[model samples]
Target: MTRNLILGALLSSLVLLLAAVSFIWTPFDHAAMNIPAKLQTPSAQHWLGTDHFGRDLMSMIMVGARTSIAVALVAVGIGMGAGVPLGLAAAARKGSWLDELIMRGNDLVFAFPSLVIAILITAVLGAGAVNAIIAIGIFNIPVFARITRGAALSLWEREFILAARVAGKGAARISAEHILPNVMNLLIVQGTIQFSLGILAEAGLSYVGLGAQPPTPSWGRMLAD
Candidate 1:
């Protein structure tokens, strides 16, 4: 399991690094039109050939990586920022009305699929990269909250938690110092999964013309084109 986790982390990191590098340099301008090269097959000059719009495929793919990565990072940030605290609160106050409220709110958010929720949000906010990030991020909040709450609840019953309580550490401090550290591994694993999902979601939204605007390459939009 450790080896597999390390390999997964390495692979994900490499992909993200490549995506970042693509932002500074690509084989060609992704938006550059070459009418003569339109729909051309791969050749010496055009490595990945040209799209119907005469844009370079390799360039488009590279630029799209930037879009995908940006969306995923922002969305994950939103999820962790909002969900972790709520989850910790729920776990610290387990069985109380606050816990019930948090869990129930998570359930309500989870009821809708990410894509459907994205569509609704895009409809209200209008389609753009910022909207896409916000929509995907909101959808991810409940997922992380539930995961964190579950892990923290288990830790709350551990011997160390008892010691912390006896030491006069408040619930919030104990949760931050003890529970969060213990459950961080779980959060890291879940964050990776959500990051991948965010990439796909951003692409899908862009493909449907509800994400990043034109001239800005997006994998989903590229596929759609």
Candidate 2:
């Protein structure tokens, strides 16, 4: 990886590590409010000072990172698992009714912003992490589906794909063995792109009171406050 990529990765990893550590041990109880120490500047006692609520800012921030990371990871997982298969299937059956249906469905999903969809889902499901994950994950589906379908379609015409068909390989077999392997790099790039988006989505949802419920620090909620 490039130096920039390495640095970004390290920083991201470090934040996640600190967040995990905070779950087990924060210098002060994150939820405990101390009016006496409220709004104090960063000092030996409170490294990042206290918030308006007198809660430890650093502790709250660490927990927020953990919540954001967890939501994003799960949301992306849902997208990749469901979207990749849909894309591959659509590509394998190119020109068929199935392809049209899938792409049309993707377009429909793409029409709405994830945050809007999340708000709707939260309204129904009563606003929580699981509901937020479902909302964001559903949104990611179309994005990955489009990327996978486009990349997989190109691979479908490759030499190996034709050879696989000639060798009596079924559509599923060819897609799994030949097409998937070749398009993985593209998928990886798409995945990286989507992950950042997922984090942002989680933040947005939390800000709107539709994600990561109370007692769980959320970056978006903190910002909204």
Best prediction by lDDT: 1
How would you encode candidate 2's per-residue C-alpha lDDT over 1-225 as one tens digit per residue? 699989999998998798789879877877787887778899988899888888898888888888888888888889989999999999999989999999999998878876788778778988888988888888888888889899998888888788889999999988888888888898888887778888898898888888888888898888876
Model 2: how large is the Cα RMSD against the reference?
1.7
Root-mean-square deviation of Cα positions for candidate 1 versus the true structure, in angstroms? 2.2
What ranges in model 2 sit over 4 Å off? 1-7
lDDT string for model 1 (31-81, tens) is 899887799999988888899889989888878888899999999999999
Q: Go through the candidates in order and give the clash count of each.
A: 0, 0
Runs in model 1 deviating more than 4 A are 1-14
Give the TM-score comparing model 1 with the true structure, all chains together. Answer: 0.93
TM-score of each: 0.93, 0.93
Candidate 2: Cα lDDT at 209: 86
Residue 195 in model 1: lDDT = 91
Candidate 1, position 62, lDDT: 74
Q: What C-alpha lDDT values do all the predictions have?
A: 0.91, 0.86
